[model samples]
Target: MTMDKQFHEILSDTRQDFSGWDFSYITRTGRMGSQLLSWSYGSMAIPLIRKAKSMLDMGTGGGEFLSLLSPFPKEAFATEGYLPNVPIARKRLEPLGVKVVQIEDDFNLPFQNRQFDLILNQHESYSPEEVRRIIADDGIFLTQQAGGLDCREINEMMGVPLNEEFAHWNLETAVMELEANGFEISTRKEEFPIQRFYDTASLIYYLQAIPWQIPDFDPEKYADPLYEIHQIIRENGYFDVSQHRFIIQSRPK
Candidate 1:
């Protein structure tokens, strides 16, 4: 650990008990914020859920987003791959008559063919072919994805390489994959919006929570950049990064 007391204190902060993909601790406190997109995934999904008779919510982290979609269909199911979140999702969604299933592989979902009339995903990886297999011919699949360049500046500033695995993940490639896998794209939109961190601690908390943001993020290894960012935040009142986001609504052809 670095010997700098203040930086060390920030590193040792225990406030970031991240769970269920919730960022409320920072967001609710106005410590972190991002510019709003033109379309709201929740707004778009609500209407689809209302019209569907059976629905599936993939990667329902802690059931946070799915729980908000009230009046769930009679045959509703949510799948979560993160182990710690499975029980949490079940506890939150089961009472709403949603079956929460723990899953391992995105390519191998545990569901029957043509099982869902609506499928919703937010920031979750999915196999386009598998999605096509499980969804009804008329079923709509809605997703809001974080593109490959999301917050790339942060990694640049930290002197780290971007995660190569998702380097080519963007709206164009995603649409191409889905179209080839039998989905007819109905609506697609991509946006790059400003994301601001009011404090250096919040930025650290965020990177720590979302490990994929900087796969090799280590306070000890990146202490110099950490101090530099902290100084910038102190002088400028905030740090800024761009958010890469896209939304797609599609159905099997």
Candidate 2:
């Protein structure tokens, strides 16, 4: 009923949902693997942050966004959808003075109305309208979304067919979505041609990570061909892949 009570309830739900998630890979200590989450924070949230009283990071993966937004807020907090991710996030965030909670439901936000002065979302699942509800009246919401062309180009190059669900990405559509939700766009940036280079084995690993390829490809069967592609890449310096993203700076209209 009360906002604090609701936040506690949401926290409980988060713990349960993320209880079984495998986070070992994400929390691993090393410089060997790429820090994709950190990359998101730097590229998406950093430039827009200004001095603010409080900040909120939605879908705060691995708590990297919290770390990036810390300087902007006197106090910062985060909410994640998965329960398992909460502890992992807290383990990394709490010491840094950021509080984290888990969200149980898909659409509802537990915080009291007008709780945050700034909200950051990178690779978030919320639609534009959903985001507007939880933000303070004058708060700014900064989000970076992977563009539709990014997926389309990847799928085309991978020789895989596209699915209907991945159809919601497009620069025009995204801008329209924000405007339709009564958000006035202040800034927009698109970064592209971001390449992830791979050796033969690494190339195979990369391809295997694609979610839509699941239940469709026999990765084991393509083992040799994957390597062959890598050998080609070796001479070529990198396998070409494009990252299309739109960073939106928005405020309620």
Report, for every candidate in turn, its global Cα lDDT versus the true structure.
0.91, 0.61
What pairs collide in candidate 2? 14-83, 18-83, 18-84
**TM-score, candidate number 1:** 0.96
Q: Which candidate ranks first by lDDT, i.e. highest?
A: 1
Model 2 regions more than 4 Å off: 1-50, 72-75, 104-106, 151-154, 207-218
Residue 147 CA error for candidate 1 (Å)?
0.5
lDDT of each residue in 6-125, candidate 2, tens digit only: 323422333212232233332242201331332354655665455567788888866854664455555678888776578888888888777888987646777766787788877666
RMSD to true structure for each model, in Å: 1.7, 12.3
How many clashes show up in model 1?
0
Backbone clash tally (model 2): 3
Using TM-score as the measure, which candidate wins? 1
Stretches of candidate 1 off by over 4 Å are 1-5
TM-score of each: 0.96, 0.73
- What value does the lDDT take at residue 76 in candidate 2? 79
